[model samples]
Target chain A: MSEKGLLIVLSGPSGVGKGTVRQKMVESKLFEFQYSVSMTTRKPRPGEVDGEDYYFTTKDKFKEAIANGKMLEHAQYVDNFYGTPLTPVKKMLAEGHDVLLEIEVNGAMKVREKMPDGVFIFLTPPDLMELKDRITKRGTDAAAVIEKRMAQAKVEIMMMENYDYAVVNDKVENAVNRIKDIVSSEHVRVPRVIDNYRKMIKEN
Target chain B: MSEKGLLIVLSGPSGVGKGTVRQKMVESKLFEFQYSVSMTTRKPRPGEVDGEDYYFTTKDKFKEAIANGKMLEHAQYVDNFYGTPLTPVKKMLAEGHDVLLEIEVNGAMKVREKMPDGVFIFLTPPDLMELKDRITKRGTDAAAVIEKRMAQAKVEIMMMENYDYAVVNDKVENAVNRIKDIVSSEHVRVPRVIDNYRKMIKEN
Candidate 1:
């Protein structure tokens, strides 16, 4: 009964494995979902495209877009700005394509304010201790940065209230499977499909 | 994240394959769910037990239960009264056992009125033409009865708005799998599991 595509937002605290889980979901190709192009002030981490992967832009330009309300949801992580472009995501959804947005928790909350109908999923680490281990194991952040991230993770984990689903990032494979099920299940959710059936009955 | 049992109500128009689909779901042994014992005024058709399969009762006693608001939902079908006893279902849910109830459309709606939290599923045939064929092929109803059932089917299908999910009974296996996904997906629904996470995070 669902013809229009769904807006699925995946977000979580830093070091919760949201990035790895989202990467696997896209690579699995089990679902027909399009990726949203986001604007970022951070330099590309090798092989990332300018428009396809992210819109690599200056901090001023990113701020301009934010001020103009051109960004759907934006946040600063590790002193670099990242935000999703508003128009493209809407255009994709309007064209009957499901859009998947992998964003930070604050940005996801902003997206929820603008698109309350979107499916918000929170990816959490198995435990706070495990979360701290993952962050420290990354080896790129300094000890102070790691400590800051641990504090932020606790606050964001508490923000699970803003999500529609809480998937534990215990294993990448398991988390993606649960995500796929949620997407498939949402397609058959009564509110999403009942109108088509209502119309079909009248015509039949 | 889900702890309390989910109340799953499966209903559809006559000949829409709700019973067959529900049977497969239960037999699949994929989900941990219990079945509710229904009260039926119809005589047992061999091998059916009074308390196990259905609570065999007279029309007067069934009416008395209905008048007492003991039945969660009840309806008269083909001169037989069929209903679900409320207290038992509630007790099962309280004990953290998911309960699946398969009933006719009218009874399903009545259940919705009382327990809006229940997951309501509407089983549908591939099409109205197919629905008519299924009813006719049963070969038990008279011509007038078939006609009445077909008319009732349209009304029931129109009542699809009252459900949370609609699965097409084109193939029993496919429908059951979709049902399994929905059940798994419901376990992660934010409202159902958010409080649990909130408590976990607070303790951690």
Candidate 2:
């Protein structure tokens, strides 16, 4: 039996260094991970590549995909349809490439509903204070917006129980290594190996 | 919010190199692992040390421990009582040391029944041919005994589904590394980290 790849759903509160950790994981090339390119009806900003940053599409096309059940999980954000495409993820899994979907907790929950077997991981800062410090260091948001974000983070932290794994993003490299180890270990999980072993033993 | 150590129950079919992998892991010293020394009523062979190889004990004391629920799992082989003591495992876990229990599938199942949260891992050879080769090279068992073992191995292989993880013992070092990765990854599991995070977040 050929081994199938894992569908990993990674979610966290904003400013938890999810992007940085994910970037390090990608750069490490320790494991074959295919990032799920999302479909968005919103106009791409400068420097964003179509089908790379997102599957940029018109609102009509996005709605049509949604109607056809092509989207694994979808949400309308600020009047723009943002959703994960189902076809690409399935194709990648069939090719034995672990697919990572880095989305918000709400989107991840929706994906979990659609695919309950997927590994759901939550990334968090060392602590709430550290998280606030990171957000403050970004220097892009107003004080009021930062406060709103911190409030939202607290709510997300409360939902940590729903995840299968919680990785602390203390150091970018360390977090990347931990996630890599997790991905490697998951390949040898009993259910996956036993599926292949059953056939091998029967032949023997 | 202190992290408690994991009770890892490792089991495999015969000739899967569980002892060699366990030795490599212990020698690596990557993590604090306390091997669960079992109490046996059998006479110690050459080079065996008390408390290091086995806690050599009297049959009366072994039976008394079993009656008092001190034994995690016990089995009688060749009229000798072989059992794992639960007190030492509990003490080691309380001291924040990951405890590794290397036992047969039957004994591992008993440990699982007592401690359901413990991680149960199954080790296996690459294939039945490799397993037969390893058993043959041992030079201890006769052909008929080896054949009997192969039949027993088939029965044990069927129980792989009950394990949480399965590491294929192709190369001894590779299997040890995979098990180490699994141990490291399990430390960041959601339930364990969330318990710590809950306390940390509450203070913040």
Candidate 3:
């Protein structure tokens, strides 16, 4: 019996290397997952196309989608609304494709509440000192901004309790392999197999 | 921070390829686990060394171990006592090694009750007809004996509800790989990480 595809939510503290790890995992082709296109009210960044990097929408449109229950989960951050659209994810799962939602802590919690069957994974830094160093080495933000982000990291780390699994991004390869292993293993759960067994028994 | 190892118990109907699957899983070496040596009052078969195949014990010694609370779980089958020892498993976990226990359904249930930490895995054949075919092809038993075993198979398959994960043994290699993936994924449990974080917080 073919089981339904999984809904995997990947959440991490900022600069924990989840983006890179996810890229590597997707490259493996071991899983059939759609990388969700988030709907955002913010203008697209340079080289990022609307509906590709994100489904860029006007503030009014974003609000309408939320009101119409078109968004699975949404959160307002930095004065912009960002959310996961329900339609594409639902369509993908129905086609037996797993859906990967690369999101933050707040959005992950919201999705978990809506879909208890979803797999929630938290990507973590190896240690706080390493996390601080990594953020500083990025050189994108000023020292003050880096410090602020590190402080926020502590709060985010605390929220990891809400996740089903935690993988430390010590190395990109290891983290990606770990996530892939989780996806492969979760498919073997009892409910899925038992449902298949029941169906087989009925037919035979 | 290091994570704690899992206690995994695997059981299935006889001739469902449980042993072959488990053997292949151990050969993968992706997981660090000690195969639990059960204490048994039955005489060892040819080429079976004490403590290697099974821990040969006198009925009196088995009773004494039970009285001393040394047995994780025990049962009387065909006038012989068979049980899992508690001490070595605890020692293995304390040393950061996962433990794999292969036991009957009742033994698995009792271990779950006593430890409440072990992971129960139920392995099933692809279909009842295939299960019967495998039993007959093995040719170790007479036709009447094979029929009786097939009857017992149904009873065991019904016990799949007791397991945390149910894997279909359609192919030995696939089942083994799935088991390895499950063990690796379970290593990322929240409690294990939170424990590490708590200790680190205390140290700092």
- Most TM-score-accurate candidate: 2
**Model 3 lDDT per residue over A140-200, tens place:** 8998898898878888888888898989889988888888889888888776567777665
Give the runs in model 2 whose Cα sits over 4 Å from its true position: none
Q: Native-vs-model 2 lDDT?
A: 0.89
Compared with the real two-chain complex, what DockQ does model 3 have?
0.66
Error of 3 at A106 (Å): 0.8
Q: Judge candidate 3 at residue A81 and give its lDDT.
A: 93
* Sequence-dependent TM-score of model 2: 0.97
Please state the error at residue A185 of candidate 2 in Å: 1.2
Query: Model 1, residue A54: displacement in angstroms?
Result: 1.4
Candidate 2 lDDT, B141-174, residue by residue in tens: 9999999999999888899989999888889888
- What is the C-alpha lDDT profile of model 1 across B98-125, one tens digit per residue? 9999988888888899998898989888
Candidate 1 or 3, higher DockQ? 1
Candidate 2 structure quality by residue, lDDT tens digits, A19-101: 78777878888768899999999889999999999999999998899899999999998899999999999999989889998
lDDT: which is higher, 2 or 3? Answer: 2
lDDT of 1 by residue, A1-204 (tens): 448889999999988887788899989988899999888999998889899888999999999998999999888889999889999998999888999999888889999999998999999888888988887788899999988988888889778877899888899999999999898888888788777877777777
The number of clashing residue pairs in each candidate reads 0, 0, 0
